[model samples]
Target: MNNQFKDWKSNLDRFFGHDFWGDFEGMMKPSIPYINMYQYDNEVLCYVSIPGMNHPKDIEVFVDHATLTLKGKIEINHRGGHQIKAEIADGTFERTIDLPFPVRSDKIDATYKNGLLIVQLHRYISDHTRQNPVQIRHLEDE
Candidate 1:
């Protein structure tokens, strides 16, 4: 009985602390730029803080109901310009997160402007119980 309870508790912890909240607290506690979440009536929005991206359009956004990944490459010339300070990281970066609820990718929208990336996952009809389903392209063996 105790082992069963432990198993359930562990699962609950992961779902809430990691899966549901996307490990926000753990990731944000470090010396790194972070992503923020916003709640709306119809959607859940995410704001990724990515400063100094030479080509903002190069960013890639991937969303699985279980997680979201943002991948991009930035080239920063440390010595190319004079009188510079320091940066946490340079070159490519990848950030991932697990959302509180399953993302509604069908109704999702994403845009990158300024130095930040914004993603909107429609929540009006999102069903957390549903996993991403597989649909075959061709119906027959060819």
Candidate 2:
């Protein structure tokens, strides 16, 4: 039937345009850096792949008890010339990662090599500060 055909065409269009290769957000959002995290017995290692970002001071890395933040800007200067297209992202980017467990903020270390940023964080056992349930009392008891 025509109705079934229309539904099939719409689904195909949606899949090809937005869902395929994650183009839904790709068209709107700038390209972001790729990262991978690994956890060990006493430390956590993170690798960030950000090409075209060379300056050390341009990137800032921070770690808290349960979070790691990475902020940086990628600038690609094009000399006076005609440009057809550019897919490389060149702008400020900030990415925050939630750690699985508490980490020692003071023992965090980072290094950049071959356009890859490596971050190492030492783990520490700390008292969790999660919300605790409170007991409710009746008005007559007080």
Full-model lDDT for every candidate: 0.70, 0.80
TM-score of model 2 (CA atoms): 0.63
Q: CA lDDT of 26 in candidate 1?
A: 51
lDDT (Cα, tens digit) per residue for candidate 1, span 55-74: 75678888887478888865
Q: Estimate each model's TM-score.
A: 0.55, 0.63
User: After superposition on all CA atoms, how large is the RMSD of candidate 1?
Assistant: 16.8
Alpha carbon lDDT at 22, candidate 2: 45
User: Cα lDDT for residue 14, model 2?
Assistant: 80
Tell me the deviation in Å of residue 100 in model 2.
Answer: 1.8
Q: Candidate 1, TM-score vs. the true structure?
A: 0.55
CA lDDT for candidate 2: 0.80
Can you list the residue pairs that collide in candidate 2? Answer: none
> In terms of lDDT, which candidate is strongest?
2
